[model samples]
Target: MHDERLANLLGAMALAIHDVMLPAVVDSSGVGVSASAALVVLGAHPGLSVSELGRRLGLSQPAAARMVDSLQEQGLVTRRKGTGRVVHVGSTRRGREATRRLLAARSAQLVDVLGSLTARQKQQLEPLLGTLLTALYRQIGDAERVCRLCHRSCCVQDALCPVGQAERSLAGG
Candidate 1:
């Protein structure tokens, strides 16, 4: 049975967390949300083409190019010609540093919010969140886009990421 109250509470919680988190993420990187996400993505998977980056970020090719231009101007990223006409994007040292700071800020904000819960509640909440994330991945069908801003290493420290697990399951692997 669909619980309207549960749905409403979850929606409110998501918005509340975004409200507190986005600013810290943006401020840490001194960039917009999308740009910060791009940095994080590049930090994890460097040397991606702008098109690939756009696909992960759910952005248009032109928009991704423009963003790369902006990052290059800020000395946060560098672009190099690939095998053919493709241009690959990678973060500079400054960009990597920015990504670290952005991730740290994001973690701090979430930690603050999670601090409100008791230890037992947090332990209980973890699996529930993983279930939700897996459901979301199934619905979205794109793990990279779904986890564009995620700290990938942390999520898989002890177990496979739920989204990744969902993706593999869908692929019958």
Candidate 2:
């Protein structure tokens, strides 16, 4: 059983981030969530197969191919042959620039939201958020999907990234 108050607050926060914040950020970046997500994933992992991308985005191979076609048409992504018949998808320079803009917009929105919290309040919230993220990764079992558009640069550099640590442990590393 979960605490009702906490659950409600979390739900509200999710709504704010998803409905309010994300839409606003996406509007400024001129990229929809799905396309932006694909771009971000491509930026993070430069040479994923279309099938692998489908797995990450919870799309079927055909759907992923359609998405790739759309992105390619938009000059946002490129596809190259890999070993065997695999086609590796990568972001183009234009795609990377779009990703940068998307990330900046998201960061600006989050910064606006976080600006309301006091320094001490933010300090107190950090570990709690990390714990929640760790639990989410465990419950969902998909780190890449769970954090598709995450701009927490710290996660890339920090040894304490809960998702990274969880994934490493789960992989028996």
Candidate 3:
């Protein structure tokens, strides 16, 4: 019961932080949350087919197309030719600019948060994050931890994150 309560509180805290911080970083601009997520996926894997992009972003193909459609209409993304005559989705100049602004806004928010953390607190946080991540992985398992990664790219590169575990499994590490 204690473990469950702890996990639940952690989940709630994560969601609460996201609720507060995401709007500070990304603009809604009448575009839906799914659309914003699509931009992030496209930024990671530019030139992915709508189908492939859907697979990566875990959306249905048609849903991915609709997201692309909105982005295209806004002149934020475009399609280019690919091998085997497949077309791929990528960000347009405007799209990159918008993404840049979004990232800058996010960075600013993060800076504000960081300013509140003392040097000693941050230093101690490093080890504590590892323990928390290990517990998170143990509770959630690899599939939910990676594919449904709550913070997406932020967790992908960290050595203690699930992607690292997935990669280790792939490489026999």
Candidate 4:
């Protein structure tokens, strides 16, 4: 049987992290969670269609369109006409800057949270977190959604990302 105490601690820790992380990301980007995610996604993969963006963010078509409209109004993103009725969304310079700030804020808050951990503790925690992320990717089955707000460069700098590795493994690659 699973340990209830472990589950509870994990849940509490997840909530605590969210509480610390969300405000920093939102304040830096001046957008709500979904919009912030959109900007991050766009910053990474420019010119994704609205429908695709919505799918990545787990939003409905109409909702995604409205989000695109709002972002355009904020001068954070631009929509260009694609072939036929498709609309491709890309980040503006301002949007890219916002994305950078959002990532920086997220990194700062996370670093602060990890400040209490010893270097040895952090080293130990890295593999544990990677294992958890891999398991999470297996369950969630959507790497893009799982990493929507992630600064990909950081995760990929040292080695292959655990989630990506999970994805590749699942795909039989």
Candidate 5:
């Protein structure tokens, strides 16, 4: 019974992310899903090294570097000198604006899809989603990768962030 429920939930999440979120953001922002994901991560955690960015995006080092180059060319990101030959990447103002627009569009799409749900149903879904996200973050063990495309504004305050709390618990904090 649990397995069936898990499978169904996973399927729904996959469809919502791949089908609904990606297409809407693409249409509105003219950014591919991967690039937008990268932007979202950078927006959330600035000054990440290229390797870290690549890790978050599940890209190889070379591929990550190339993506950073692309982002730099588009004026969406900037690279700054970090300690001891490390280059840290950060989103430019343009990148932040783009990310904001993409997230807004994504939220609008989600609202449209869930608009029929009663307020009570929406309230009930929040805790369930948080629990699921926390569990998934624990299993994945990589916060940036897991949350690369998440809209930070929707996250419960930092104190209550599921992924953040999951990570802290794992760290024995």
Candidate 6:
């Protein structure tokens, strides 16, 4: 039976996720998610070129350039040019540290959120979550290689949200 309880649970789950994911989300100053995404790619690749970073983050050249400029100004990133418009951007020590802190905080938040779930609940939920997530992603992924291509908000929110903390409702493995 389609119950009100299910709807309330879903709404609560959505709100909780939005709260936990706030730190990791890098919304642009006057930009969109694309600029923030570029930072992740650049941070991981370190010395990737502007063009390469742009492609990796799925941003236009102008957008990537703007992101790089903002990052450089913020001191979270730096860039160097080799030759013929070959520019490389790498994360600053500050950026790497920030990433670490953010990840750790998020992990801690998740731990606190699920502190009460019994072992059985987790066991039941993991598999169901994994399967459902896989199916959802598959359905969405089949549409486009890049998420920004999809206007659907979940394209940005779902994966980043720490839904694992809600393992009790999950019907895990």
Give the candidate number with the greatest lDDT.
Answer: 4
The 10-residue segment of model 4 with minimum total lDDT is 1-10
Quote each prediction's TM-score.
Answer: 0.97, 0.92, 0.70, 0.97, 0.88, 0.59
Residue 108 CA displacement from its true place in model 6, Å: 1.7
Model 1, stretches more than 4 Å misplaced? Answer: none
Prediction 5 global C-alpha lDDT: 0.85
Candidate 6: regions farther than 4 A off: 1-12, 23-40, 51-60, 82-86, 142-173
> Tens digits of per-residue lDDT for model 6 on 47-155?
9888777776656788788888987887778898878989888878876665454444444565666777888988787666656655554554422223322223332
Could you give the candidate ranking by TM-score, starting with the highest? 4, 1, 2, 5, 3, 6
Residues 113-163, candidate 2, lDDT per residue (tens digit)?
899999999989888888898899999899888888876474667447788
Please give, for residues 1-173, the per-residue lDDT of candidate 4 as tens digits: 47998999999999999999999999999999999999999998999999999999999999999999999999999999999999999999999999999999999999999999999999999999999999999888999999999999999997899998999999998
Count clashing residue pairs per candidate.
Answer: 0, 0, 0, 0, 0, 7
Clashing pairs in 2: none
CA shift of 116, model 6, Å: 3.5
TM-score (C-alpha, index-matched) for candidate 2: 0.92
Better of 1 and 6 by TM-score: 1
> Ten residues in a row with the worst lDDT in model 3?
143-152
lDDT of 1: 0.94
Distance from true location, Cα of 149 in model 6, Å: 18
| Candidate 5 lDDT over residue span 1-173, tens digit each | 69999899779977876787788887765667778888999887899999888999999988888888988898999999889968899998898898999999988888887787899999898888789888999888998778887887788654387888889889999
Model 4 spans with C-alpha error above 4 angstroms: none
